[model samples]
Target: MNLSDYLLAQDGHDWPSLLSDWAEVLPGDFIVWIVNRLGDLVVVLPDGSVHWLDVGNGSLKRVADNREHFVSAIDEGDNANEWLAIPLVDACVASGMALGAGQCYGFKVPPMLGGAYEVSNLEPTSLAVHYGLLGQIHRQTKDLPDGTQIKFVLSP
Candidate 1:
């Protein structure tokens, strides 16, 4: 899939709230314009800098000074592979997967639970569900040891 295929609507208002649980760790206010295969966000920060919100791991970091730099950075070899995840996207597409406008490809077993970075672990999911679940799960398990056995229970 082409990189442009990943660009979500630029309306920032909806994203922050949809992913609010995962976005609490962000460096302040921002707008989400893109999402990677694992449902990570590419956001333009208040200072005109672009940052990556690794929702799966609940981490954020600046990717470029601005949108222009962000475009170049995303197309530049390694960053392209990591940020765009074309290969994975293509695999998902070929496997008969489809996502709605408000959805993305999300991990069936998130990395925090030892999910492998493979197409077999992906599914089309609403952004709210992906980030909300990951945010809660990661927060609960962030301090646990690698092999620590713990039960993950979701409650209303």
Candidate 2:
């Protein structure tokens, strides 16, 4: 896999180096390595879904259902300090998705507040909604949840 031109500038490191670093991780099983926000390791699965390896807990968290949604969410998200926007956009463009001013699509945030979930057992529709793609969703949060909200995109 090659890093998009836009992505190459975002992180300086090339695809080979990134892949090498990801392979060094224990129990390596990532198809495509994205970026590491702080200690959170972001990777892409064989099916094109995005996941984050929580180094602190030694767990993998679903970030997006697929690359498309991942790109859109990151591109539209706060990128001033978060350098993930360009990389995400590059990933999508590299995948051959035509994204620009009015081409990109957005999704609604998922119902689950925050925290990570099993990548294998995820609700695709919920993920789409969470990314702001589907119509508005109301969860009526009953209790005070823990941790920040996880932003998952893509349709399952």
Candidate 3:
């Protein structure tokens, strides 16, 4: 089967189905999969890489920085199910696999539950900062394309 065939088999919001399809389609050397607090699916490659598949109810927007487009899906009022796709993410994973790299890790952030008006003891801002720090650490330690590093932040 060709790359197009693999891409065609994937569904945008179904995480498990998508993952299974990805594994069959690409069968890369390494696949580090993660299910975050917000139900977002993250896949990291052998080269210490990460990619976020937005499967949450959020608003997807393209942020322009340094002449490049960075896609972000933000969970906001009313429209909480918006989704975003990491462009060429699958290709990157397939390429890494073809290169014979092998190292995969999967992690999941615990879910946060509450009504819109309820304020939790944990500050959302602080949590964001903590995740941001973790993303930075991953990037510095892993050798991936520059644009790929920022992709983690936009993930769930």
Instruction: Return the top candidate by lDDT.
Output: 1
Model 3 agreement with the true structure over 13-108: per-residue lDDT tens digits: 343433442342222643434333222444544554444443221111222221112122223332222222222223334444221111111123
Q: What lDDT tens digits, residue by residue, belong to model 2 across residues 38-69?
A: 22346777777877643323345676788777
lDDT of each: 0.76, 0.40, 0.30
Candidate maximizing TM-score: 1
Predicted structure 1: clash tally: 0
Residue 141 in model 2: shift from native, Å? 30
lDDT of 1 by residue, 63-103 (tens): 89999998778777688777766778878878988877767
Candidate 3 segments whose C-alpha is farther than 4 A from its true place: 1-18, 23-27, 55-156
- 2 or 3, greater by lDDT: 2
Show the lowest summed lDDT stretch of 10 residues, model 1.
Answer: 6-15
